[model samples]
Target: MVLRIFGLSFAVTVVSIIIAALYGGPQAVLLVVILSILEISLSFDNAVINATVLRRMSEFWQKIFLTVGIVIAVFGMRLVFPLVIVWLASGLGPVLALDLALNPPADDAAYFPDGSPSYETLLTDAHPQIAAFGGMFLLMLFLGFILEEREITWLSWLEKPLARAGKLDQLAVIVAGGLLLLTASYIAPEDTVSTVMVAGVLGMITYIAVNGLGELFNTPEEDENGEVVEGSSGGPTELAKATGKAGFFLFLYLEVLDASFSFDGVIGAFAITSDPIIIALGLGFVGAMFVRSITVFLVRKGTLSDYVYLEHGAHWAIGALAVILLVSIGYHVNENVTGLVGVALIGAAFISSILRNRKAAAAGGSSDNDVDEPKPVTIS
Candidate 1:
């Protein structure tokens, strides 16, 4: 099962390394390997979150995620996203932006040796707005998830209070908006405050629009009396698997979620190397494929169902990342610190899940072992 799931990722890793060797010899090969590891480690939580969404999708859309979605993720995000940022941030036309990326100026300290900003400089210079947008979007995601009432709780001490707060309509938006304004006013640079505000508001709007549309189109499961039936354990229920427009919006949400997660990784790749080709090879070809494969593995193996707290862990990691991104606008946060924070949260969750499973087994709760079969979902 492992080989079947990850075979393509492994194969791509080999080919990408070979190409990197040819492009810049052993040094490029090493950089690609490091960048791939960096992306995977940084995005481990992303894979878990993705699995939660992917499991709701039909097989057709699942294939689309692997095939067409991969094309978008690899080329559109890894390569073109940087170019767009440079174009918009620098007011350079698309042609010049592409040219700058292809032929980055020589580095000297911060700026180019010729005193012009390098491609990396332009990209990093745009970090405040990027962080604002992606950070707000992810913050909304985390907030919305934790605020909702659920049958199962991972960190009951914290989640119980949040769930009570969820009883208030739009509490998630209220908190997220307050944070955005606070960060923009005090945390972001004065000159970039307006830009940060606009980006952050747009991020909040995008999440609401997509998620709202999805829920609007989704038809929840109904009992014989036509009453809606909620999930027993309360995460993504079978309603999430709706086809047509609901599915499309859910798919759109997944893509945006991925972009938000990848924002930091794409920008951080410059610290390793400025070669766009190498970055794409490592992040797009190698890192992204493995994330997709891991998502598939989790969905097919029912890993999320088996380890109930894993989803909670991933969302908490996302919350931490959101805070880090917002904090990074005003202060430099080490990439290692960002990565380790996520790892630590997820590791703790995993251990907690094991203990729960053992306790259930010791109590001879055989009923707890069975995963609920997804019910048929209606789409309006």
Candidate 2:
């Protein structure tokens, strides 16, 4: 499997290097590799999350995820999301920024000899803003989770209705993504840190809101053969199909969510190193392998049921990332604190799950295998 993964990655690296060098020549190869590594580390959790979703998708969609999804990820999110985020942070978009940074005034043409913007000018224009964006994103993620959690308590009266409204996991993610975009555009300061913070926090929000609400609304059902379907509300036949679709969409949602989580790690890596070619190739190839393997593991090995609350741990990490990003936006976001708080919360949850498992064992309580896991799904 490792060799296979490497071989696949080599193919992808060659592709990325070719793409990166389209403008900058062979020198850009270094940049692609470096970026690739950064993305892989940041997106490990994303792979686990993707597996949960990939398991539910049709084989056709699964293929789409591996191929088309990679395009969306490497090109759309990695390449384009940064520019959009930076534009939002600075209030001067690519065109305007290029004009100002290169010309020192919007009035001049500011055209490069090659008819392109200078590398130094663009970097200087966006670095501080990206950092600030990253910082803000982390902080907001932390606060939003805490805040939304509180809303759960306050909405005791309308709990059922609101939950129903929030029932669509896809909608929840869309909302979170939209919110992040809005915040980055309107609220975050114009600096590099802020840009990164916004992306990270948005990723955190989408993960938390989608997963949290979906978990809350989860119910169980019974099949025609009288076998119980885990995590269902005992709904009728029609809803069972809906559940299947929801399960499938939930999987797609996870992939998008993972992509978002990967943004900060990708960008932060730039500060530690240079070489865009290395950056792209390394991050794209490694991240691809990680997510694909995870998808396979969950589908084949049934690991999701075995390790209950592992996903919860990831969501908590996203929440912490949000706060870290936010704090870093205006001030400094401490890695230790960000990591510690997330670890504590998720650790406590995991321990609680283990303890629950132990107690269940003592009482012969049902395992998630008997609960969350159902009969093997057929893609047909």
Candidate 3:
């Protein structure tokens, strides 16, 4: 199963390494490997969260995810997205932006000898807005999940209280908006305050719009007999796997989520090397393939069903990432710190899940197959 799932990723890793080596020799190969590991480590939680959504998608959409979705993730986010950001941030034309990315300044230089800002500088300059947009979107996701009531809780003490507080309408929006405002007013640079506010609000709105539309158009799954399949729990039925228009929106949500997750990684890649080709090879080819494979593995193996707290862990990690991104607008947060915090949260959750499983086994309860049933909370 492992080989079947990850075979393509391994093959791509070899191909990416070879490309990197041919493009810039052994040093490039090492950089690409490091960047790939970096992306995977940082995005492991992303894979978990993705599985939660991807499992609901039909096989056709799943293939779309592996094919078209990969192109978007690799080129659109890794290569083109950064270039677009540089273009807008620096007032450079698309052609010039592409040129700047390809012909970056030398190491230890922030600007070209001709006095123009390097592609890295332009991208770094754009970080505040990027952070604002991506941070708020992810913050909404985390807040929405954490605020929802669930049959199972990973951190009950905290989650229970939050769930109770969730009874208040639009609390997540309120909190996220307040944070964005606070960050804009005090945390972000004065000149970029307006930009941050606009970007952050847009992020929040995007999340609400996509998620709202998805639920609004959601229809229950039907069995082979055309009977409505009831949810796992008795009371309210679980949201059916989205299809048609709903599926397109959900897929759109996934892409935006991927872009948000990739923001920091794309920006942080400059800290490793300024070679766009190497970054594309590492992040787009090798790292992204593995992430997709991991998502597939989790979905096919029913890992989320088996490890009930994993979704919670991934959300918490996303919350941490959101905060880090917002904070990074004013301060420099190490990518290593971002990666470690996620790993720590997910690791702790995994351990707790195992313990819970063991306890349930001792009680002769069938917990191994239990899945999280987070009660649907209205996102106004």
Q: TM-score for all predictions?
A: 0.92, 0.55, 0.91
lDDT of 3 by residue, 219-309 (tens): 6667799887765211111345666776777788889999999979988888999888999998999999999988888877777777778
Residue 209 miss distance in model 2 (angstroms):
12
lDDT of 3 at 374: 32
Give one digit per residue, the lDDT tens place, for model 1 in 1-380.
78988999999999999999999999999999999998998899999998787767666777777788888888888889988988887667899778778776555333234465767888999899989999999999999899987767899899999999999999999999999999988999998999999999999999889888877777566678977676622223233455677667778888898899887998888889988899999999999999988888878777777777888899999999999999999888888888899989988998888888888888888434344544322111
- Checking candidate 1 for backbone clashes, the offending pairs are none
lDDT values for all models: 0.83, 0.50, 0.84
**Best candidate, TM-score-wise?**
1
**By lDDT, is 1 or 3 better?**
3
Total colliding residue pairs, candidate 1: 0
Candidate 2: how large is its RMSD?
Answer: 9.0
